[model samples]
Target: MPRVFLSFRKVDSRWMRDRVYQGLIGRFGAGEVFKSGESIPAGADFAEILRRQAAECELMLVLIGPAWLEARGDDGMRLIDRADDWVRVEIETALKAGNRVVPVLLGDATMLPEASALPHEIAHLARLQFLRVPETHLAEELERLCAAVADLMPDIGHGSASPTAPAAPAAEPTVTMTAQVSGGGSAYQAAGDQTIRLA
Candidate 1:
């Protein structure tokens, strides 16, 4: 299971979300961070997996971009107002699970909507202290966020390499093979640098 869950409206914050994912992965390793797009397996149940991850994760970062609050659906209604909205469900699940939920304001986003503007289940998000990642200070802000997460989750170690760094080549294993000719045929045995005797 992932240690951190990233919650965001794709239409509103895909770019910023991707950046934040990269930053967190760089600091916490890819296996420790969960973003829906890369974390979910193909042909799997979406809602079930999302809720399970949100509830099980140790930390949930809610990425709120400039258009997050105003993002509308087909009928011009705000997406967050819908109970079935993926972002809302993720936040609500995390909150209900009592996981550490951090609001990340991206780009020009300065604040969250009023409590009355959000659903009852997620209204507390409006009152939480949020982290601001301005366009000009993304890298620094991301580092700060990583430090904060590390402080909150002592089990997660900070990776020295970036998320896109290539993995080192695996060392080749050494094997020893022995063939014994008995009464009828031959028997062969292989082990890791170990000789086997057939009797």
Candidate 2:
């Protein structure tokens, strides 16, 4: 099972979700991160998969784009307010299971609504501090988010925390020398991992 669950509303933040998902996959490996539709099996039950992943994951990132709170269903009710909304179920399950649920504010998403504005099952989402992924500084902010997730779930392997290969040794510095020649000054340059003493 994946270590991290990405809870998102497709219409509201699919692009942002995909971007974050790729960054997380890069850090945590593709098998360690879960995004509902993309990670689920073709013939498997969607609701069961979502609930199981949400409940079992170590971290749940709720992608809150600008429209997340207010996006309405066909009946004009806020999607978050609906009991059957997948996003709602995902978050609620994670929260109920005592998993670490983080609200990630996607591009231009300012903040979460008040607790009272949300359904009781997921209302605590409003009280949680959020990580912002602004479009302007996605890479930098994404690194911060990835680091934070790794810190919170250090037992899980992360690229930054556990590199695939040991880092290469630093290159030796180049050395240049100028010596007086019979006709004119001469210059010489050498580069290698070596120590030289001029006599």
Best by TM-score: 2
Worst 10 residues of 1 by lDDT: 157-166
Candidate 1: lDDT of 6?
Answer: 89
lDDT of 2 by residue, 154-192 (tens): 867644444587789997676655444465546445556
All candidates: TM-score: 0.77, 0.78
Write model 1 residue lDDT over 1-199, tens digit each, in one string: 7878989887876777788899888777888988889989999998889989999998898999878888998899999999899999999999999999989888864577789988899999999988777777779988988888888887685443224557898977665454567688855656565666554
Candidate 2 runs further than 4 Å off: 158-163, 166-199
Which residue pairs show collisions in model 1? none
> lDDT winner among the candidates?
1
Model 1: per-residue Cα lDDT at residue 150: 83
Candidate 1 global lDDT:
0.84
